[model samples]
Target: MDDSTLVASSKSGIEDRLSITAEFYTLNNVHANSAKYVLLFSSDPSSVIFFGLSPPPLINNNTLTLTSLALTTSFRFLGVWFSLSASSQFVLKQARSMVKDMAALLTLKKLLAQHVAYLYNAVLLSRLEFRLQTSLFFDSIVQSIIFPMFSIIKRKAGLASTTPLALLYLKIPFSIQHAFCRFLLGKKFLLILIFGNLPIMLFLIFKNLWVLRVVLLPST
Candidate 1:
């Protein structure tokens, strides 16, 4: 078959699979409400390609179409922001706003060091660390914004701006926190592979061997 025909057939197959899944859920009485929100996101870095086309409409077994699907530049899923270009800029922006608001409150209240730490853990830190596993692109930009806010709070609380003091009060730096989260996720994946079926176990072993070979052997 021609490329265009193959593409069309693949699209049809995907739509059919979605329809069958929706029907299964409907039979199970899932999402009995008529209102449904669907979003289409393209991972393409180019804006032109990302926004060029709309996703296919999803229809239920009763022929009810989900018309609520809209083209959005970004959307929140499971507390993590996902953008069309796969950039973490939106997440960083949101984190900045949240930290600023919390900082303003801390300054206005003239909160004690202990109180400020509690507030930071409850509000600002929670937001910063929320779904950290999903937003690994939060790099130096996020650290620059967050660490300064910590300094401001520390100064207000009459604490030194030293790294040790910051670490003592904040428990761990954001970079370290990110690394810990990644390590935990890696461990979880390893455990899954260890207990997984034969095919998955084989794939994991092969993947690790390939990675080790790539790291140990120089490219010729």
Candidate 2:
């Protein structure tokens, strides 16, 4: 044969062998069963029939009760409002009983001691309740009381704003203090109420009035 004819015959033989392998792979379900290649025999295709092995029996659904509570790995704060309410009610009742029993003792010193402790607890409980209910009112009272006290302290420490008086009446801080001192030391003590504190008092009053007007105007 010529060189071209010989090459063509060799290619045809290789193609025929590949075609046979492909046909076998497509037609057969060849699976390795074990590490050592154990042959498994089966008849039913819908259900798996294990050969040379006894299958475990299925448990009956009705006989198996699933009362297993799903345990949550979490912290739950409030399970129910009844639990919290009942707890607070119990504490309140206990405190009331303690207070009543102490009152019944009737000795002055013991009564005072009991009253002091009760008052402290009552104040704390009232504060807690106030925070829970009427929060705005409680906050307003706190702000009103604290801000004025702070302002007074700031004023006494040579730090109070003299700008209002200065803007309204052209008086410096030293002059304001001097004026207060003179009012305390002279016949123009009426001017103490008139000048020293009058402006601050009037300013607060006017501020409150303006706020009230604004609040009421919306309603009206």
Best by lDDT: 1
lDDT of 1 by residue, 1-220 (tens): 1001001123234344445545544465444332322323132222221111123344334333332212345555444565544466667677678777767766767556666656655656556666343455434565665665667656765657774533543453222233333335545654565577765756444331100000111222
Model 2 segments beyond 4 Å from truth?
Answer: 1-87, 106-220
What lDDT does model 2 reach? 0.27
CA lDDT for candidate 1? 0.45
Top TM-score model: 1
The TM-scores, one per candidate, come to 0.46, 0.15
lDDT of 2 at 119: 39
lDDT of each: 0.45, 0.27
lDDT score at residue 196, model 1, on the 0-100 scale: 72
Candidate 2 TM-score to native: 0.15
Each prediction's Cα RMSD? 14.6, 36.2
